[model samples]
Target: MIEQEQAAGLNRQQQEYLDVQGYLLLEGVLSPSEAVQYRQQLLALAAQEPGRINPTQHVRWLVNKGADYRKLLLHPAVDPWFRHLLGDDYALSTLTSNVVRPGAPDGRYHTDFQDRVPEPLPEFPLTANSLWLLDEFTPENGGTRLVPGSHRWRRRPPPDLAVHPDEIRIAAPAGSVLLFNGGVWHSSGANTTDRERVCLICFCLRSFMKPQFDFVHYLSDEAYAEATPELKRLYGFTAWPQPVDEPAAPKRRL
Candidate 1:
């Protein structure tokens, strides 16, 4: 169990909401100092990233590359929440980050996974998006935009050029880490502020699910060797066989 000091910090119904709606808001979990460091490392990374942007001119698939920024990927809150949802055998996809420069446009509303299943939603869900807000996620700053309960229905709209940027905005504070089920309908909002908005988005999944970012190619053998066994398991090193070797994985401590 989380100690009273820490557990007391989380709202009572937050985890319940995450389980049912595929998302939850965690307030005040990060320190201002942490946010400052995250922004520093990510900005430097974004400057060096060479990949093509998705119409946003920001970096993507930048986990292993941002080694210094990995702390955000392994926060105390994230581990407990992720273990609660995905179980002990799960792996850390990577340390995903992006620097949303000023004038970047609002994004499309859509689920983060492939659209295929029964007419209605599936019995179970897969995929999770853990976003560590390095800046104030304000309506004016282009914080992530999400429909409250769209995850239950599995519905979303494409990036609507017509919709005003403010319509679906969610303003989160600098220390707030937003954990949502991947199927939740949402999009990255536009940054109107002159300064850049940097975010550390860590993708995690059940041990058996295929990862979104290619962890295999992103991590080098040297990094893997230096990483501890737990870190290795988090990076897809220990292959959890098909059909699930165990049920829900073992209970996790800390």
Candidate 2:
């Protein structure tokens, strides 16, 4: 758990909202120009992929993409929540961008950690996700749909249900961020507009949880060398034991 002093980034009201509503919208987390730049960069990367589909596209492992993407690993507006929810040693599970094309359909409602953890989810959050909006989010433009207060449900949404009565679509400006507990039931809304909706997903989990990608092993040497200590920690380099062959080096705790 994070010490009270260290978790001072959020105020009592904000904390209460998250604890009760399961999600919080942080507006103006990025400047309008920055959001536009990220959108362009992500789209350019997506365009490079072969056999790309129209409905939706996911550009994964963004930390290796560029310096702009790397800066997001420790964005001041978003990092504190990760520490508050997952404790001081939280590790980033993945940094990926999601593009919902004009014809994209509504996504399935589910929690980020439900598949990994057993049924009857824990009372506390095990994971947290921050959606950095690169374009304005609207109901017609595939804004995220979430069931308020569902994080405390302690179970997954019903598979057969198409939409819950309590579900509400989130609408925010381009530079805003939607931060939520991993247990909240949510889905990407359908995109009916002519333009595509873009957002960078920064997902973090407790240090003990397995990450979606093995960033420590797969990260390029250059990237590792350039990473700051906080980035290294977020990449989970110190959260687990490293493999060794022959005689092991001097033992040390993570």
Candidate 3:
């Protein structure tokens, strides 16, 4: 059974909603100005890499690209919930952004960690995700769709299950953050509008899991030096250390 600690970052009502629905949308996590700033930054970055700006553009390793990106790693609004769900030792798996352009088709309905885990998914969450809405999400603008309580299914959705009957499209203003369990069934809605939809995805996993990006090696010396203790932990510094073998004696027999 999942722990129901009253001291967790979320209040009882918010916690209950997540437990029953498998996801929660926190409004006003970012101010309107902040959201606009992030949206512009992401678009500018996307422009630099035209090859990636397809129907759905993905900009990866955001933390390495800018100081602003690093701030979201420990954003006050969402940090506590991560600790409550994944524990203090959880590590960031990936910091990336997704931009769904106009005319983009609907994404497949699936769970986040489905590919990594086995059948009969574990009761406890192995990972969690936060979608920082840089643009207002609307039914006509490629908002995300999710099935309530799908996290408890303990199995992956059928390949033929194009759309679940219970699936609902999210509609929210910019600056809202959607937090969900990794096992929840979800997909991105098609963008029928003329404008592009953008969001920053912060996917996190238990410290034991292998992160999507090798942040430890990829993080620059300058960035690492400037990182706070909490940020260092989020970057996987607190994960179990890998064993390093000593060099073998120089070829004495040669």
Q: How far is candidate 3 from the true structure (C-alpha RMSD, Å)?
A: 4.3
- Residues 127-237 of candidate 3: C-alpha lDDT, one tens digit per residue: 899999999999889999989999999788887788898999999999999999888999888999999999999999888888888887788666787898888888887
Could you tell me every candidate's TM-score relative to the true structure?
Answer: 0.78, 0.93, 0.92
Q: Which ten residues in a row have the lowest lDDT in candidate 3?
A: 245-254
| lDDT for each residue of candidate 2 in 149-184, tens digit (9 for 90 to 100) | 999988988887789999999999999999999999
Compare candidates 1 and 3 on lDDT and give the better one: 3
Kindly list the per-residue Cα lDDT of model 1 for residues 146-185, writing each as its tens digit. 7766667754445554464434577788978888876777
Which regions of candidate 1 are displaced past 4 Å?
1-12, 50-63, 116-119, 156-168, 240-254
Q: Select the stronger candidate by TM-score from 2 and 3.
A: 2
TM-score of 1: 0.78
For model 2, state the Cα shift of residue 204 in Å: 0.5
Q: Give me the displacement of residue 15 in model 2, in angstroms.
A: 1.1
